[model samples]
Target: MRPTGVQPIPLASALGRIGLAGSGIRADLPLVSGITLDSRSVQHGDVYAALQGGTRHGADFAAAAVRSGAVAILTDEAGAELYAQAPAAAGSDVPVVVVPDPRRAVGPLAGVIFGTTDRDGAAPALFGVTGTNGKTTTTYFLDALLEALGRSTGLIGTIEIRAGREAIPSALTTPESPQVHSLLALMHERGIDAASMEVSSHALEFGRVDGVRFEVAGFTNLTQDHLDLHGTMEDYFAAKATLFTPERCRRAVVLVDDPWGRRLAAAAEVPVLRLRTEPADEGDDVADWTVADVEPSGLGHSFALVGVSGERLVLRCGLPGGFNVSNAALATIMVLASGVRLDELQHALDRHDPFTTEVPGRMQLVGEEPASIVDFAHNPDALERTLASVRRPGGRVISVFGATGQRDESKRAVMGAVGARLSDILIVTDDDPHDEDDAVIRRAVRQGAEAAVQEEELACEVLEIFPRGAAIDRAVARATPADTVIVAGRGHEVWQEVRGVDVPLDDRVELRAALTRYGFSVLSAPRIES
Candidate 1:
């Protein structure tokens, strides 16, 4: 639904544009400044949209919205009935416009209400990244590259929203439909010249990006995630595929790292530029962008970003893991594909890595002298890669991680096995055990870790600890001066989800406290800032 705002255009004019004017909408209905889905956030001259929610219809809150000064409402037939039936709304004069599906129209309607169209002047080139993982990191990379090119960048992702100089903590990987449009409009208002956003499968399938047109659409890689929401991997891929269509975006930069991506690149309707991370993916002529001459550095990996034109832009990657290298390369190619001048980016790089800027919680080194690292690697692929990347030169790898509750349970065992196989020590802990038995979750992970130790005939020690904080402490306390402690999952997040409530928890904070508890000195310079 819409959010609170000033009603600028006449409600009739907007409804007429969408051919909804005669459908119980008064021609002289109040002009709305903005739109909001939240009834609690309704303001004067606002159009509140009552949508079908998972638990309850938003129409149930229409009276409350009206009380908060909502002048009009857009809802489905069922919500309209409820609004009419409510005693408080029985005689309420607020005009209600009924539609078959409010979610699909919220973005478009919001665009009209907030003037997200060209009448306000051109909006910055919109770029977006979609994938199971790396969406946030890719957006960070894209925004940094854009800024280096002298563009006032706007970034919207899982961690935070950056509009010009303002940064706000994000509530969703992709915000609600109206919020997406409204935020873009606000970015335009703030004189942003370019924007990058992370598009989740849920956002694509749920109409969150309905009316938004991306200039450059990027795909990092697709993996098994949100199976409960999409029901199958094919369904998940299809939802992501929607973002690459000519209708949604004009140009596409797809990473052909996995089969899903290869398929997407082949099927995408727009002008496509495919990026490959494999140095041995033979037939270099088939790839548009390729990774070559990759080398492991002391802090991270460095690779040559080779474009189709046969020119290589080599840079050191400050972020860890091959996946990160792929993300960095994809970000560079995406920027260039967005029609950015290669010389500008090359000049911006000078000799530094695009990742010279800090990427919070993505291999964030919180302490040294028995190095402690915190990252947001929650899935099997991400966890495995992070552990492999942080393997000590002649030391051991200590991994502390857990599976998220109420998510793709199918991936839990795989994640456990990966951590167990890759790390010298695996400490299984809780990672957002929301509404699920924490013990059951822990047991499932330990079972997989133990199974991996048996099947692979590997010699990795595994431990299970209740509560995440104690797990962090135990992992760090057991490590020696030469060992590395890597805590995966929940990066840049200040809270942990437990039993439907958010408890204040930061992985970096916990890791640092654990290091202090182990008497580890801070005199050893932190390799990477959290």
Candidate 2:
């Protein structure tokens, strides 16, 4: 939903500012109060963006949008033609602003309509973190860090959007450009000084974050995923690199652990502070910030952030896994690059334990007896890291996971291979098989596990289970006190899509109930609101 306190702008002035004007209408006729791409979400005085889609043109629903109170139409040449032929346009005089590319124009239109683009010290300092795995966790950590520094913060990510303490559940990692701007405006209205946002490659490629420039953009790492949308690794990396451009952000804090991060550090258009969260090779260039002296602390680890000039800040993460260290280090460096003094950050770190903030679904703990956990490790790299981190000294790792249907089919087998290599028992199950056959999806995953087991002669037990709830039950029931049960792929996701229907499924709830039924002691309910 859009904010309520927006100042309406005349349609002619808004169009002229963006260099686009409507046809067959008076300049002073319509006043623009808000902008939205969805015809169903149209409000009075809103500009309905009717762009062409893959299969159907959005203009097909212009009648609905107009009825819902859209005063103007924004579309491409093709959409304009279709809207003109629509029955709703038979005698209608609604202005149609046709552009060469309407998707790109939506961001600027929303920006002008929402007053977010030309902020006069009102917009929150936007911190954008982009990567395959750590975006959510890093953004959460950033929000906590900013709050510890006595700044009011907001968050926009896969889990939800927050303005002060109010939260709205999110459907995308980074929402459409209009919502992105509107949320920032809402945060400004609430006196939030800063906001941490998860910027996915899809958001960059689809123009979801076009009109916003970040104070500091962070890169976690690049890995194979979303090949269904982007066909190659280079294309995926290219989409992420767009966030580091001068038009998108002022400065960048890039993690140079993987080759992709190193490449981004060398190629970012904005000034960059290179951070190394992992060990560096002898020939690698010296990083601006490095993580050192990492030691196990409770469920997580404590580490030192050593700057190139010998400045250091020690911090601890309450989250499990070594990868969390990378996530925390990225958040710390991003805050430091934003001008927070080292001593101040260290004080905040010590006083508030900001790095130990609980991220809802990233390595979320549900039980301690069998060490049951849930994570959003749908990709190959994330699955490998998660599996390795959950393995105990004498405990067997029993993993239950599945690949998402119709998305990056190439990662399915690789994820399966990784799971088999790391987990002692891998159970292939169903994730969101949106419109694809569930059995077919499970077969691909199972085949990969079988192939890996046979080729490597690994002593791993591979099983196939259907209906994700039953899979979680089986994994937990089979586990002993010494085993670690991990349910991955669909963490924090509360529904599963089969064909066109959304079935209710929450991994944490299911895991918690199963653990209780198995007589295992589960952790208290997660305190962080989703």
TM-score of each: 0.95, 0.97
Q: What would the C-alpha RMSD of candidate 2 be, to one decimal place?
A: 1.7
- Model 1 ranges with Cα > 4 A deviation: 1-7, 19-24, 118-120, 280-285, 522-530
Residue 220, candidate 1: Cα error in Å is 0.4
Candidate 2 residue 81 C-alpha distance from true site, Å? 1.6
Please name the candidate that would achieve the greatest TM-score relative to the true structure: 2
- Candidate 1 matches the true fold with a TM-score of 0.95
Error of 2 at 386 (Å): 0.3
Worst-scoring 10-residue span by lDDT in model 2:
20-29
Clashes by residue pair, model 2? none
Candidate 1: tens digits of C-alpha lDDT, residues 1-530: 22233348898898777556676666788888878889988878888999998999999999999999999988999998999999997667889888777888787787787766442354678889999888888899888888877889998888888778788788898988778778777777777889999999999988888778898999988777789899999999999999998778999999887888889999999999989897535643367888898998767777788877887787667766778888888889888887767777787766445675667888777766787788999888778778888876788999898888898888888888998899888999999988999888888889999999999998999999868989998888888988998989888888888888989888887788778878896533323222
- lDDT per residue for candidate 2 within 1-530, as digits (tens), equals 45789998997787667777655435774788888888887889899999777789999999899999999888888888998988879899788877788899898878888888876575899999998889999999999999999999999999998999888899899998988988888888888899999999889998999889999999999888888888999999999999999889999999999989999999999999999989998899999999999999988999999999999999999999999999999999999999999899999999999878777778998998799999999999999999999888789999999999888787888888898999899999999999888898888898898899999998999999988889999999999998999999988888888889988888998898898888888888633235
Q: Which stretches of candidate 2 lie over 4 Å from their true place?
A: 21-26, 525-530
